[model samples]
Target: SRPWRRRLWDAVQAAVLDPTNGLPKELRAQIAGVAMAVMRECAAEQPDLEFIAEMNDHFAAALWR
Candidate 1:
């Protein structure tokens, strides 16, 4: 289950890093807004501190790259 989650996360990260260039601007913004909302909800649920920290680190690293 953990491995599956990791794979899913990797796939999402890849998609975020390399989004479809052909997507309309409005559609892209809508997608990103929804994604952020979902992430915020997950954060609010407070599942695991370590997992949150790891995800934060991953996003931080990706942003820097």
Candidate 2:
């Protein structure tokens, strides 16, 4: 079963924040940066779908590039 979005976000933030998670420094920063943006948007009363989609696109590009 898949985890909920909130749970997934928690895991991602933990990995990015943990120094011993073993992710490369640059990669961790990238993930943390995107997570922060997404978190902020999600906190809004009415989250913007377009912004979330754009962030997803950018993150996917970074990952696949």
Candidate 3:
């Protein structure tokens, strides 16, 4: 398993948590929820590539909004 990936997740979670980061709480929550879901699928014994890709697309679209 790639431990650094988890560290990346930790960083995302931390950003959502830190109010000093300046992002609105609601937007942070929305993005973070998808990130956490991606982490869960990645941690699974058989990660779903399709789901991960779907989540990635969703994240990209979210960024544009």
Candidate 4:
């Protein structure tokens, strides 16, 4: 279960970061939501506030770019 969740997280990150994929804005927003949800879930389990903030910052920057 943990391995699968990690894989899902990795895949979401890759999709969000791929610049040439030409994903629609709506779809990208949905993907970003998923990524945030995953991060929140992981943070709940581990309580890594700094890592969570870093991930949120990175995600926001990617969204703007």
The number of the candidate with the highest lDDT is 3
Q: What is the C-alpha RMSD of each candidate to the true structure, in Å?
A: 11.0, 3.8, 2.6, 8.8
Q: In candidate 4, what are the lDDT values of residues 1-65, reduced to their tens digit?
A: 34454454667767876776688867877776767676566647565656655666776698699
Model 3, residue 46: C-alpha shift (Å): 0.5
lDDT by residue for model 3 (1-65), tens: 64554565667778887878788889889868877887887788888878877866765686699
Where does candidate 1 stray beyond 4 Å?
Answer: 1-20, 46-65
Minimal lDDT window, size 10, model 3:
1-10
lDDT of each: 0.53, 0.73, 0.75, 0.66
lDDT of 1 by residue, 1-65 (tens): 23433443444544654556565767556545544544554545444546545766765686699
Per-prediction TM-score: 0.42, 0.64, 0.65, 0.47
Q: Rank the candidates by lDDT, best first.
A: 3, 2, 4, 1
lDDT of 3: 0.75
- Compute the lDDT of residue 10 as modeled in candidate 3: 65
Tell me which of candidates 1 and 2 scores higher on TM-score. Answer: 2
Q: At residue 13, what lDDT does model 3 achieve?
A: 74
User: Which residue segments of model 4 deviate by more than 4 Å?
Assistant: 1-4, 46-65
Candidate 4 has an lDDT of 0.66
Question: Each model's number of backbone clashes?
Answer: 0, 0, 0, 0
Off by over 4 Å in 2: 1-5, 53-65
Worst 10 residues of 1 by lDDT: 1-10
